[model samples]
Target: MSSPLAFDPARMFAVFGMRAVDSAGFDREVVQAPGDDLRCVFLWGKDCYNCNVFKQTAMLHKDALLDLGLTWFECNVYDDVALGQRFSLHGVPAFMMFRHGKRLGRISGWPGLPQFTEAVRRLRSGPAAPPAPASTQ
Candidate 1:
């Protein structure tokens, strides 16, 4: 495997492996799923124990995610701090969802694959409800 800092989208499938691509590649596969596909970006950092654990969980639940027709990508935050910052990611081992170049939702932290799947399901279900309207003068 290449250095953790390198972005390689192809290696994202391997255990704890994520594409160490540059910002452009990150835009292509991650920011934009390209052809309207539901995509999931696994945001992690080096030396992050929780990030490692989350990856293991993703490896185990790969099938489940596939069943949901979700495309996966691995993004090392340290490799692209800008991207992480843009997504408002303040922690490692975060999951960001996107479709047709638009962000759907995100779930941060290691809440287990089941919970992650559930959250993704929610994201897939439909748009989140808007806040109640404020009273008019």
Candidate 2:
């Protein structure tokens, strides 16, 4: 019989192929635009209950990640304090999506699956361009 699992963030993520990244790794891979494509970093903490739940919920739909076509990374912000500071993150269980070395958007907290999915959709679409100024004519 299989034994119960302990909350090892790295091991948990490894099961689904999310490479654990440190702040330097994040900057080199995600922030540097490894391929000028969307890169997503799942920021989490070691002792945060919500982070654990969020990770579980995300594990349910691993394909949702593949469908998004972005590189996936998991970071233990509780351990990598510099990462949290780089993004001005004040909390855990956040998803930061970046492209071309710029942040597209972020979904902070684990409200629920529906809200999270919708937020991902918006972030995937990326920031909207500003409207052109109207002429007086």
Candidate 3:
């Protein structure tokens, strides 16, 4: 068992694999308008019933995904409203997939690992280009 406060990036990659993006550093504004090629994980705080379940599942999957170098962002809904609406989230534990700043797909509720894995694979297989680097040339 891991400490509650401990954040293990490697664990996340193992579960989500290469189809996830770690958005832990993302600001509220950035998530609202994420650039191309970024997939976000919206983490609703413990206030919501669904959020609590999602967090637990996420914790278990985090270690697996982390080991595989997968990417994922954890966004606390309490911290951002604009982002929530941008994804049109009507409930907690929502997983929104985006590409080139456009929504590609989403799955809401406490989906089991198999379902979650499939959703991620489908999104990863979608046609989404990487964001262009800022011009410093």
Candidate 4:
């Protein structure tokens, strides 16, 4: 059988990884936007099976989203402790979708590719009117 695809955290991090968001910026960008067409953030703590699954799913969707003019941000739990605490991320492989800085949706654990795609679609479509205010508010 063909060898399993290698898991290169460095490469993945480079491609999908997020930059350091200072406390103020993280609060404004991730915790304070207020619309449907917001940004997408993926938080990963460890290189576990679930995180791997999500990574693959993201890879599949990355190109499509790029074509659609969508934005995605990746946060390494080890690197972003302050952001992690802000989100109360006690688990790895967590997915959070935001619009205008407000959290539109969140999915944790390994839901596989299908579920991940669905979550993205839903978030992209925006919350069903009357969305909650930004996190900072």
Best by TM-score: 2
| Candidate numbers, best TM-score first, in rank order | 2, 1, 4, 3
Number of backbone collisions per candidate: 8, 0, 22, 5
lDDT of each: 0.70, 0.74, 0.58, 0.63
Runs of candidate 4 exceeding 4 Å displacement:
1-5, 13-24, 31-36, 60-69, 127-137
Better of 1 and 2 by TM-score: 2
Model 2: residues >4 Å from true position, as ranges?
A: 1-12, 127-137
Q: Which ten residues in a row have the lowest lDDT in candidate 3?
A: 18-27
The regions of model 1 sitting more than 4 angstroms off are 1-12, 15-21, 127-137
lDDT string, candidate 1, 64-95, tens digits: 75677766677678978887887888898887
Candidate 2, position 58, lDDT? 65
Candidate ranking (lDDT, best to worst) = 2, 1, 4, 3
Error of 2 at 102 (Å): 1.0
Cα misplacement distance, residue 9 of candidate 2 (Å): 5.3
Q: What would the per-residue lDDT of candidate 2 be over residues 1-137, giving only the tens digit for each residue?
A: 54576445455577556767897767777777456566678899887988988777666666774576667788888888998998899898888877767777887887786786676677667644434689999
lDDT of 2 at 101: 72
**Cα RMSD (Å) per model?**
7.2, 5.0, 7.5, 6.0
TM-score, one value per model: 0.70, 0.74, 0.58, 0.64
